[model samples]
Each structure stands twice: as structure tokens, then as C-alpha cells.
Target: MSFISIKNVWKYYDDNLVLERLNLDVEQGEFVSMVGASGCGKSTFLNMLLGRELPTKGTIVLDGETLKDEPNADRGIVFQKYSVFPHLTVLQNVMIADEFSSAKVLGWTFGNNKKLIKEKALEFIQAVGLTPAVAKYPHELSGGMQQRLAIAQALMKAPKVLLLDEPFGALDPGIRNDMHELIHDVWQKNKLTIFMVTHDIKEGFELGSRLWVFDKLRDDPQAPNAYGAQVTFDLPLAERVNKNNVNEIIEKVSRN
Candidate 1:
């Protein structure tokens, strides 16, 4: 069985259909990159995987069971915008993730528990190369540094799946390249199943083991929302294949 199964899924907000017939199976440790035009429901699909949203018609299964209709520590997400606490230091921001999981009511830990969480947070901070800014608040950090902090916070949960919604979209070209390397290292070191939505086709090809293109197979001009988008292409980025056809894949993704 697949590690994550999305079978015959469809999403709707009222009468506006968003996704139609999204059937795909994702294996563990596979880095799947999603690309498509804006408003094509890429983020919505990621939300379903994270359990923040439910399919209006179908179901999403994770680890052999149906996914719950709520967010949990099993899945972590980092958005394009920094999802950090502005009031907290870098260390505190990462530590709070564990606190929320361990001490739900208080959202804080004490004594040995606090010490362990702090140590773990520090480890992740270092892994993301943010140890220098451990004491700085979000407002004091650069865009790339803030995003790194966000990545550290997500990894603090040790999630089975990592969902990234254009996590590097806001960074400068140099900073974005650095982030790409960092994420690649993190994914390999942790053996994480990652689904990233990217507008950059080149980034998608460079980072993902597999690529998915979401596009509308049918369109009704009279009623735009009458039909929704689906997976128009699924490409496996094998080393040789990717090296040989990078431009071809980019062209295909860009045409839609």
C-alpha cells in the first residue's frame, strides 16, 4: 500500500468546484513538487494532506488510515510568509512547538522537560544555520533567516510529512539558492515525505524526486467553476531523465 493515498478526491467551497478526481499515491521519503497556474488548488491539496481541510466528496488516507479532518504533529507546514512568533526569540519560537504538543493547556514546559525541548530546538536551529540568531526576535531577522526559523519550527515536531507552500518564493535569488540546498539536506537527513508547491518550474525539477502538474482538463466558459482542475501530468525525476529533459519538463509545466 502507498504511504499516503489520495483517491478520487474532490474539493468544493459551496457550489464552486476547486479540485476534481485527484487520485495519487505518495510513498514515504518522496519529495513531490506541485506546480500549476494560480488558483488551481495546489495549496488546497496541501491543506487536505495536512488535515486542515477535507475533501467535499472524497477521502485522503495517510499511513494506511483515513486522514483526520484536523491538523496534528504528524504533518508540518511552512508557508511563503514567515510563520514565526514575532514576540519570541528564534530559540523560543522553535521550543514552543514542542511545548504545545507536550503541555497543551499551558503551552509551556518546566525543569527537565524545558531543558530537553530547548536542546532539541537548538539542534534544529543549528541544522538550519540559525544558531547565530538564536536570541534574536523575528523582526530582527532577514527574510531568509526568518524562513529558516520557520523551517526549524516545523522540523521541531518531527513530522512524518512536510508540506511547503512556496516556502522560498519571497527570498532573493541568492537566498533562495541557499534555501534549496538547506531543504535538500533536511529532507535527506530526516528521510521526510515532502510535498512542495512552487511557481518556479526550475526549482521544482531541481528539488523533487517526482513532479505533479495540476491543470484543468475541462473548462466551461459559461460557468467557469463548473469543472475543476486535476493532475494533468505526473513526472518522475530520475537522475538521468531529469538531467536530459529538464527543459522539456519546464516547458510542459509552463505551458499550463
Candidate 2:
């Protein structure tokens, strides 16, 4: 069975339809990447998966149960911008996840398991290559280091599913390359189910085991906003296809 099932979903903003009849089945531990033209409902789909938005029609299921439509420890997300708190040090940023989540679930105080959580935070921080910056505040770090801290923060709960939205888009090409490697290792080590949304076709194809191209199937120049997008192309990189062929296929299908 699919770990994440999105069945016949549609999204509407008042009279405007953003997504129409979308369906997908994402297996556990699969790394899926998505690409689409801007305003093609890519972010909307991610938000729905994150439980930040509800679909206008149809249902989404996770682990054979209907989605809770609320944020929790089951899923985590990282974005392109500053994802850490400027006022907190890196260790505090990581530790806060344990602090809040435990409080919510166990009615716990910081005194409970303080040493264990700190060690886990530090371990994850070091894993992300941010050990030296443990005591530093977010504002004092470089863009790359700040993003690393964000990643550690997101993984604090050991969520089963990880969602990334243009996570390295703001970094330099060199730094972005480093992040790509980091995330690849993190995914393998944790066996995480990941879904990333990227505008860079190469990066999307390079990172994902499976690629999902979202684009409008029909276009009306006279009424551009009337139609919506779907998963026009779903391909597995493990198949017998080269990068050039994959790129050509994505380019061909992404046209509105």
C-alpha cells in the first residue's frame, strides 16, 4: 500500500480552481521530487500534505488513515529562507523541538530528560556539520550555516516524512551543492520519505528516485486562470532513461 495517498484532489480559491483531479501514491522511503510552472499548485499541494491546508475536494491519506489536517511530529518541512530563530543559539534552536513537542504530548518540563535531549540535539547538529556553531546565534552565521541549523531543527523529531520547498534556492551554487550531498546522506541514514519541490529540473531529477511534473494540461489565453495542473509526468529514475531524455520529457510535458 502507498504510504502517502492523494486521491482525486482539487483545490479552489473562491471561484478560481488551482488544482483539478490530482492523484498520486507515494511509497514509504521513496524520494519524490516535483517541478512545475509558477502558480501551478505545487506549493498548494505541499501545504496540503503538510496539513497546513485542506483540499477543496477529495481526500488525502497517510498510513491507511485519513490525514489529521494538522501539524505534528509525523511530518517535517524545511524551506529556502531563514528557518531558525534569530534570538536563539543553534543548540537552543535544536533543543526547542524536544522541549515543545514533549510538553505537548507528555506535559513535561525542561528538567525532564534535559541531558538526553541536549545530547541528541548536539549529535544531530554535528551530523549536519554544525558542531562548532552550536553556541552561535542564527544572525551570526553564514547563509549556509543557517540553513544547516534549520535542517537539524527540522529533523529533531525524527519525522517519517520530510518535505522541502526550494530548500537550497537562496544559497550560492557551491553551498547548494553541499546541501544536496548533505540531504542525500541524511535521507539514506534515516530512511526518510522525502518530497521536494524545485524549479531546477536538473536538481529535481538528480535528487529524486521518482519525479512528478505538475503542469496545466490545457490553457486558455483568454481565460488563463480557469484551468488547473496535474501530475503530467511521473517517472522513476531507476528506469532505463538518461538525464537528457528525462529533461526532454519534462520539458515537453511542462508546457501549458
Candidate 3:
């Protein structure tokens, strides 16, 4: 069985159907990217995987068990907006994640293990190339640096699946490229399963080992929602890594 299985899922808002019979399977240690225009149910799908939103129909299973209604350590999410606490230092941000984990396993007094928690937080911060910024607050860092901190915080939890929702969307091109390289390196080092939603076709091809495209048509009023969408294509990561093949896939998605 796949590490993650999303079987025949459907989502609706009031009477509007956002997703119809959507199904996906992600293997262990795979990097998959979901690419489509805005409001095509990309984020909706990620939320379902994270168990933040339940499907109106069908099931989402991970590691042979159904997901709970609340978030868990098994899944970590990084969003376009920085979720760092403004009042906390970089070290504090990551250490707090450890504390949360410890609290779940131990008790609420995880803050007492200051030395051990600090060491773990520093380890993840250094892994993400943010050693020097550990003492700084979120406001003191650049946009890219803040995003890196977010990534570090997420990784500190050692989640089974990492969900990135347009993490580099707000960064400049140069910084975005650098962040992409960093993410690729992290994925290789940890062999973590990753799922990202992106609108940039180039970035999707660059980072994804497998790509899923969603095409939505608005012209059909008879459709359940304003957006009548379909899962148009699925391709291997190797094909996308090649420049020519990447362009071909981009063209194909564009035409859809």
C-alpha cells in the first residue's frame, strides 16, 4: 500500500463542488507537486491530507490509518505567510516546537528541559543554514530568511509528510531559487515525503519528482461549481527534470 492514499475524495462548499472524485497516492520518500491556477482546490487538497479539513466523501489514509480531525506531528505544513511568532527569537521558535512535542509525549513542563530542547532547535536551525540568525527575531531577518525559519521549524518536528503551500511565492526570484535548492537538499538528506502546491510551472518542474495538474473550466454553468475541474495529467519526476521535457509538460498543462 502507498504511504499516503487519498481515495476518490470529494469536497463541497454549500452547493458548490470544488473537487470531484479526486484520488491520489504518494509513496514513501517521494516529492510530489500539485500545480494549478488559484481556487482549483489545490490548498483544499493539502488541507485534507493534513487533516485540517475532512472530505465530504471518501477517505484519506496515511501509514494504513485514517487521519484524525485535528493536526498531528505526522504532517507538517509551511505556508506562504510566515507563521513565526513576532515576539520570539529564532531559537525560541524552534525550541517551542520541541516543547510541544515533548509536552505531547511527556507533560506541559517541557520548558524545564532547556538544554536539550535548545540543542535540538539549534541542530535544525543549522541544518537549514540559519545558524547566525538564531538570536534574531523574525522582524530582524529578510523575507527569505524568515521563510527559512519557517521551514526549519516545520522540519524540527520530523514529520512523515511535509506540506508546502506556495512557500516561496512571496520571495524574489533569486531568493526563491535559493530556497528551492535548500528544500531539495533537505529532502535528499532526510528522505521525507513532500507535497507542495505551486502556481509557477518552472518551480513545480524543478522541485517535483511527480507532478499532478488540475485544470478547471468556468464556462460550464451546468457544472456543480463555478469551477469545473479535472485532474488532467500525471508525469514522472525524471521527465520533468529534463529541460526539454519540463517545457513539454508546461506546454501541455498550459494548453489544458
Candidate 4:
């Protein structure tokens, strides 16, 4: 079975259908990048994967079992806005994520495991190239640095799946490139499945081995809410043309 599966899924907010007849199979440790226009159900898709929302029809399965309607430690998420605590130091933020997850699973504080927590937190901080900023507060760090913290905090829990919602969308060009490398590096070492949502097709194609393009392909003018977004293409980058050609392919996909 696929590590993550979405079969005949449809999502609707009240009467507004957002995603329709969506089926996907994500292998473990594969990076799947998603691209689409705004309000095209990308965020809704991620929310469903993370178990924050359930599909109105069909199933979302992980490891043969259907998902529950609540967030769990098996999945970690990082948004465009840093979700780190403003009052906590970088190290503390990373430490708490691990503690929180463990507390949920073990039904007790990992407080006794503080010594190990500090060690693991530091390891993830350095993994994201933030060893120096460990002592600084969130506000004390630059935007890129804060993002690094967010990545570290998420991965510190060692989640099976990581969901990134345009985590680098707000960064400067230089910093965005840096984050791309950091994310790839962490993905390599952590061996976690990833589903990232991005507006930039170049970024999507660059980051993932499999690319899923989402767009509204069919609509009725009389009833705009009746139709919903669906995958236009699922392009595997393992055997493909060069970078420019790959971008060209996605450009064509986006246009159609």
C-alpha cells in the first residue's frame, strides 16, 4: 500500500465544492510538490492530509487506516508565517515541539528527558544551520533564521510526514534559495514524506521528484460552485527534460 493515499476525495465548505474526485498515492520518503493558483484547494488539500479537516466524500488513508479528525504527531506542518513562539528562545521552541508530541503519545511529561531533549533539539537546530541562533528569541532573528527555526522545530519531532504551506513564499530571493537547500538537506537526512504547496511552479518542480498540478478544469457558468479543482497533471521528474524544459512543461500545464 502507498504510505499516504487519497481516494475519490471531495471537499466542500458548506455548498462550495473545492476539491473533487482527487486520488493520490504518495510513497514513503517521496517529495511531492503541488502548484496551483490561489483558492484552488491546495491549502484545503493539505489541511485534509494533516487531519485538520475531513473530506466530505471518500477517504484519506495513511498506512491502511483512515485518518482521524484531529492533528497528530505523525504529521508536522510549517506555514509561511513562522509558528514559533515569540517569547521563547530558539532552542526552547524546538524543545517544546518534541516535548509536546511525546506528552501526547506517552501520556506523561518528557520532562525527565530534558537532557536528551536538549541534545536532540540542538541536533535539529544545527541541521537547519541555526546552531548560533539557538540562544536568540524569535524576534531577535532574521526572517530566514526564524524560518530555519520553524523547520527545525517541526523536524525535531521526527514526523512521518511534513507539510509545508509556502514556507519560503515571503522570504527574500537569496534566502529562498538557501531555504530550498536546507529543506532538501533535511529531507535527505530525515527520510520523511513531504507535501509542499507553492504558487511558484519553478520551486515545485525543483523540490519534488513527483509534481501534482491542481487547477479547475471544468466549470459551469450557471453554477460556479458545482465544479471543483482537480489534478491537471502528475509529472514525475525522475526521467524528464532539462530544467528549462521542465519549467516549460509546468508553464504549459498552468496555462491550460
Candidate 5:
């Protein structure tokens, strides 16, 4: 069975319809890069996947179970903006996940549990190239460093799925390239299933084994919000392709 499944999914916010007719099946360990025009329900889809938002209709299933209408350790998310605790050191930020799981009542772990959490946090921090700054606060780190810290924090739970919403969109070109390499390494090493939403078409093709384009197929000039976005294009990127084919896909996305 597919690791994750979306069947006839639709989302609405009161009178506004945001997404409609989404049906997909994804296997474990697949990296799916999602692209769409602004306000085309890309972030909304990610939120649904994260369990922060429930579908107004239909259902999302993960690991053969229907998704609960709340976030859980099975999934982790990183956004474009840095999501870090300003007062918490890098190590502490990552350790919080373990602490929450181990010491829910106290909000902190002690003794041998604390030691083990610290060691595990250190390993993840090192994995994201943040070991040297383990003692630093979020404000002390640069944007890229902060993002790396966020990724490390998210991975602390050892989630089966990772959701990235424009995680590298704010970085400089060089820093973005570095982050790309870092994320690729992290995904491969962890054998994670990743769903990333990006505006960069080239980055989508470069990083994902599969790509999805979301767009509204039906439009109403009289009532603009009457219709909603859907997955207009789905492509497999595992095969080698020349520049022309890539350009064609780019054009197709742009035209819609």
C-alpha cells in the first residue's frame, strides 16, 4: 500500500472553495516537489498534510490510518520563515522534541533520559552542520543557520514525513544552494518522504523525484472564488531528460 493517500479531497473556508478533487497515492521515501501560482492552495495542502487543517470533504490517510485532525510526531514541518525559540540554544531547541515525548507532564527530562536526549539532539545538530553553534541562540545565527536549526529541530522527532513550505525561498543564492545540498543529504540519510512547496520550477525539478503542479482548471469571471485549484500536472523526474523537455514542463506550468 502507498504510505500516504489522498482521496477525493476538498477544502473550503466558509463560502470560499480553496481546493477540490485531489486524489493521489504516494509511496514511502518519495520526494514530491509541489509548484503552483500564488494562492493556488499549495500551502493549504501542506497544512492539511501536517494535520493543522482538516479537509472540508474527503480524507487523508497516512500509514493506512485516517489522519487525525491535529499535528503529530509522524509529520514534521519547516516554513520559509525561521521557526525557532529565541531564548533556546540550538541543542535545547532540538532536545525539546524528545523532552516532550519523554516528560509530557514535567515538560523536561532528567537524569539518564536528559543525557540521552542531549546526545541525540547533538547528533541531529551535527547532521545539519550546526554542532559548532549548539550553544548559540536563534538570534545569534544567520538566516541560513537558523533554517538549518529549524530543520534539525523538526527531524528530532524522527518523523516519517517532512513538509517544507518554501524553506529556502529567503536565502541568498549561495546559501540556497548550500541548503539544497543539506536537505538532499538529510532526506537520503534519513530515508524520508518529503513534500516541499516551492515557487522555483528549476529547484522543483532538480530536487524532487516527482513533481506536482496545482492550478485552477475552471474559472468564473462572474464569481472568481466559485472554483478551486487541483493537481493539473504530475510528472516523474527519475528519468533523464534534455533541456527542451524541462522547458516544456515549465511552459505548461506557466501557461496554467
Candidate 6:
């Protein structure tokens, strides 16, 4: 079996069918991006992979096991909005995440274990080029830096899968590009499996080793009011053309 598999998955909200018969297989250590317009079920899919939401009809498997009731430490999530504790310094933010992942509640109690967590947190902070800002609180940093801190907190857990839900969407273009570069570097260094949901088409093409487009269709009988969305295309990064060809591909897919 693939490292992560979604077999004929279907999702619904009350009577609205959001996704239908979606199947995907993600290899270990691969970076995949899911892209579409807003309310296209990208976040829902990410939640499913994180075990926060169950598919209405089908199954999702991670590392050969089915998703459980609660999210495990094996998967790390970074959302667009900064979820860091404003009261905590950058170092504290990361250290707390490590402690929680390690199942240690005494994160504030200074000791050998706490020191080790501190060291690990610092290591990740430096990895994301935030060592100098580690002493500052989230309020003291710029928006981009806060996002970087959030990324560091997620990576500190050493999760087997990293799920990013438009983590850089709120940043300016320059900062967003920088975050993308940082994400690329971190993925290369750690070979972590990533499943990202983004609306930026360029970002999706740039970061994804494989790309999946979720498109809604009204032709299906099962989906009339809220037609079940379909997986229109899946392609490797190498095969995907640049901006010049992307429009053509999109146009072709839309016509179908």
C-alpha cells in the first residue's frame, strides 16, 4: 500500500456533498499540493488526513493504518492564521509544542528534560532562521516572522506528515515567497511527507511534486444541489508546464 491512501472517499455536510469518489495515493516523503477555489473542500481534506474529520463514504489510510479518533503527534499542521500563544516567547512556543508531542506536561519546570526540549526548539528555530527572534514574543515580530515561528513549532514535533493549510496566504507577496523557499528547504533537508492546501496556483506548481485539482461538477446525478466535486487532474511537477501552459491545461480541464 502507499504511505498515504484515500480510497474512493466521499464527504458531506448535512445534505451538501462536498467530495465524491476521490481516490489518491501518496508516496512516502513526497510533497503534494491540493489546489482549488475557496470552499472547494481543501481544508476538509486536510482535516481528514489529520483524522479530525471522517469521510462520509470511504477510507483514508496513513502509513498503512486507518485514521483514528484523535490526531496523533505523527502529523503536524500549520494553518494560515497564527496559532502561537501570544504570551509566550518564540522559544517557549516551540518548546511547548515539543513537550506536548512528547507527552510531557511539565514543560515549564526547568530540568534536564526541559533543557533538552529547549535545545531542540532552538535547533528548529535556527533551522527556520529565527534564532535572533527566539527571545521575542509573537507580538514583537512581523507577520512573516510569526508565521515562521508557527512553522518551527510544527516542525519541532518531527511529524511524519506535515499539513499546511494556506499557511502563507496572509503574508505579502515577498514574505510569502520567502516562506515558500523556507518550506522547500525544510522539506529537502528532512525528506518529510507534505500535503499542502493552497489557492495560489503558482505556489502549488512550484512546491508540489504532484498536484491534485478538486473541481466541482454538476453532471453527476448523485450531486445536483451540491454536486460532488471531482478530481479532474493529477500530474507530476516535471510534466506540468509553466504559466504559459498552465492556462491551457486549466482551460481544457474546465471544458470537461
TM-score of every prediction relative to native: 0.97, 0.93, 0.93, 0.94, 0.97, 0.91
Number of clashes found in candidate 4: 0
Off by over 4 Å in 5: 239-244
Task: Please list the residue runs of candidate 3 whose C-alpha ends up more than 4 Å from where it truly belongs after superposition.
Answer: 103-112, 217-219, 222-228
Could you tell me which 10 consecutive residues in candidate 6 have the lowest summed lDDT? 101-110
List the lowest-lDDT window of 10 residues for candidate 2. 103-112
lDDT of 4 by residue, 1-256 (tens): 9998899999998999999999889899889999988899999999999999999999999978899899888889999998999988998898986666567775335455877888988988888888988899998999999999998888877789999999999999999999999998888888889999999888888888888888898999999898899998898877434765876796697787
Q: How many backbone overlaps does candidate 1 show?
A: 0
Per-candidate count of clashing residue pairs (backbone under 3 Å) = 0, 0, 1, 0, 0, 0
Q: Best to worst by lDDT, what's the order?
A: 5, 1, 4, 2, 3, 6
C-alpha RMSD values across all candidates: 1.2, 2.2, 2.3, 2.2, 1.2, 2.3
Query: lDDT per residue, candidate 6, 1-256, as tens digits?
Result: 8999889999999998888988888899888888876777888889998889899999989998989758888899999999899999999999996676566564454668778988888999999999999899999999999989988988987899999999998999999889989999999899999999988767888888888888785555665646677777787776445668877765664455
Q: What is the C-alpha lDDT of each candidate?
A: 0.93, 0.87, 0.86, 0.88, 0.93, 0.85
User: Candidate 5 local accuracy as lDDT?
Assistant: 0.93
lDDT of 2 by residue, 179-226 (tens): 999999998899999999999888887888888888888888988778
RMSD of 1: 1.2
Measured by TM-score, how close is model 6 to the native structure?
0.91
lDDT of 5 at 176: 95
Kindly list the per-residue Cα lDDT of model 3 for residues 102-125, writing each as its tens digit: 677653344458778888889889
Q: How close is candidate 4 to the true structure, as a TM-score?
A: 0.94
Off by over 4 Å in 2: 104-112, 239-247, 250-256
Spell out the clash pairs found in candidate 1: none
Worst 10 residues of 3 by lDDT: 103-112
TM-score, prediction 1: 0.97
